[model samples]
Target: MTRHKLGFWILTALVVGNMVGSGIFMLPRSLSEAASPAGVILAWLATGLGVLMLALVFGSLAVRKPELSGGPQIYAKELFREGSHGSRLAGFMSTWGYWVGNIAGFVAVITTFASYLSTFFPVLTSDKVWVDTGILTLKAGNVLTFIVCSLLLWGTHAICMKGMNGAGRLNFIATATKVVGFALFIIIALFAFQKSNIGPFLAPRTNDSGETLSLLSQVNAAAVGTLWAFIGVESAMVFAARARRKQDIRRATIAGLLISIVLYVGISILTMGLLTQHQLMASQNPLVDGITAVIGPIGGKLLAALGLISLLGSTIGWVLLSAEVPFQAAKLGVFLPSFSKENGKGMPKTSLWISNAVGQVLLLSTISGSISAAFDFIIYIATLAYLVPYLIASLYHIKLIWTGETFTTRKERVTEGMIAGLAALYSLWVIIAGTADLKTFLLGIVLIVSGILFYPLLFKKGKVRGTSN
Candidate 1:
């Protein structure tokens, strides 16, 4: 099969689309409860910087080894395979992490879409709505969740099935709409903010021990929770081989990342400034709340619709990248050979179908829960898997610099490598900070075990030769 024919616009969309998803629509309120408005802004800024660094590192690696198949996985495998001291197991784990992170990204978008719909329609947000039998007590806003999420999934698939051209066009519109939506949200919130709502910007409250604690802790928590907004900065690196110009990969990723940073930080600050900690914490969809408060009901609904579209775009782009990761890995002999198969559409049919199938399964299982709860669970587990690759990629950067092997411009190389190293450390820190429940952690272990068990099955029938598409 020929490699996917994505150009600069599609590549940029992938970066922007992947980074902008559900997080922008819902993260602000959750973050406001944890920290002050300033904390939320700082969190956005920090996450943006860390993730941008990741993109730069990945871009540098892609430029250096333009022919590699897997993203961070390829970099790690090459580092260890070419006589470096790194472990082959580390390379293997990195591949698994990247794959799992994409799955989490899927879950995040779907849940956020569901959360937004719940606002317009309300029964979907409650756990009891689904359990009470035949009461016909249709919650006013709940049905919208399932409807919107289904539409998003199918609509994205429809465009994607048309090939990369359709997806590229959709991505352009979706990315622009997403950024504008957030910008409008911020502008409205600022104009409508009430001085009363800004009360006690840093209030001191009594703790359980009758001691006072600063109100900013909540904002700190909010910042940490909202940090995942920047997680998809590596979107360009995954499909680097498909870009119009090899070097354009760095420019596209960096530009897209910076764009999202502006959107995320601006909206987050406005949201916190307009709503009290109690109001922000209690909000189901903070961005929507801020918009509704600033504009009118009509504006809120329009924003929700835009948010839904943005979520769909992110899902489509994420699914494409997620499916490609395994397919590319399989072609490189890092996964089962069956995954390398492609259909007449030039799609990695088997891989794409399997990835979609798994994502659907996740959606069905978690749709009944609180959107934020479901998101964190998926993200925490996925982060565990995704972090391994970041670390390996960062270490690879250090190795290259130490060996004095040139990749891109010397300035670019040094900057990319340093950023990669910092981002890697930050990724590890985030993973440690995430509080994954027992079920998710166990599920992760089971998946890892299954991967290890199936390793030899994929390698059977003699040595696998490198297959170039």
Candidate 2:
């Protein structure tokens, strides 16, 4: 019997749903704090161009190497000679980091879900401390937020366990609800928009240390936050084996990206027209706040509902994606054989559990800080983890062109070269700028480098692809 393959619409929904997650509802706050209006706008432009190149790379390679699935991390193998240790290790490490990053991405989604739900239940975002000790101080709101996040994560896991079809349908419904809801919000904002709220386009921003940031610094600061909005652009590529047509993988990626870019830009920019930068920077749910400022408190609740729906769909999509990565990598023999195990429903049960189990630990991280702070922490780590595979993939894209492996015409090679070049630089630039904070950077390094401990697991069964030993 043949497996039910995902068609363009389902594939596109998966890509869009994952990319348009919690970031959309909350990014206005992050961006406003990171940069002025001009810097934020420039950041989006730069991110859009760079991510398109990366998306194109996925599309180009998806068509050129039809057999390769599981996104650019799998393509990392080809960056080295076939059957070499470098090829196997590179692929394994890249997939490992990507998988870990994906787990954190799920945590980010659910944590933001809790944030939006806080709009209705103020306790979830409350700062009231119920217990304090020299070793630990516990806030009532943080504990409740953790509970909310964990329940949402596992509940999605349960639905996913029933089978992909059920989860896919559920995600599709949630995605549609958000698309319509946001469209309505944008229309309403247009009428209620106040131009005076936009303030100066390029006013200097002050950092937490009270230091004034230059324009370049502001753009650098906003780049990572903005790029987070597009982090899941490769969702369709990651599930390439399940695509009804290999070519649909490319189409779905580009289509999903264009869809998300429009929604993100509209929501991000239009909110500025509704609320002042200071108000936006302080808002936990900026979209809700923007809508509230426009219509009334009723608008805030409605947008909050939209955020919950959007985040619900995103959580489902990313959880599916994160599990699929390990399962696909294991099938390709780059990950542990345990992850390749599937249940009666043809789902990666083991991989799903392990991935969510790690995410459960990550959810605990929200128990001590503000919800937005926790969201930022997890997303930073995830974005860092994700950029490694992206940089590796961009380098591999360049390598293919350099060796004349995928193209025939000089024009084709030159075109692919420029795309690969820009993507590689973008990846490197974000990695540098995002890691400027030593503590978070070091924390991200520790999580990724910890993958080395499990590196030996790749060969424990002596089954890793290209393993010669």
Best by TM-score: 2
> Model 2 reaches what TM-score against the true structure?
0.96
Instruction: List ranges where model 1 is wrong by over 4 Å.
Output: 1-4, 82-89, 122-151, 195-199, 203-224, 407-417, 435-450, 467-469
lDDT of 1 by residue, 1-469 (tens): 3355666767788888988887777676656544555555555666666676677777777787677755776666666544232433444456666776787687778878788776666666654454344744433234445556666666666566656556667777878788787777767776876767755656544434565535444433443466667667777787775677887787878888888888877776667666677887778777777677777778778888888778877888887788778877777666667777877666677877777667767776454455666766676566556666776777777788767677536886676667767877766665554433356467666655556655665547864544333
Record all residue pairs in model 2 with backbone atoms less than 3 Å apart, i.e. clashing.
Answer: none
Candidate 2, residue 37: lDDT: 91
Q: Report per-prediction Cα RMSD to one decimal.
A: 4.0, 1.9
Per-candidate TM equals 0.85, 0.96
Give lDDT per model, in order: 0.68, 0.87
The top-ranked prediction according to lDDT is 2
Query: What is the TM-score (0 to 1) of candidate 1?
Result: 0.85
Alpha carbon lDDT at 305, candidate 1: 85
| Model 1 residue 52 CA deviation in Å | 2.8
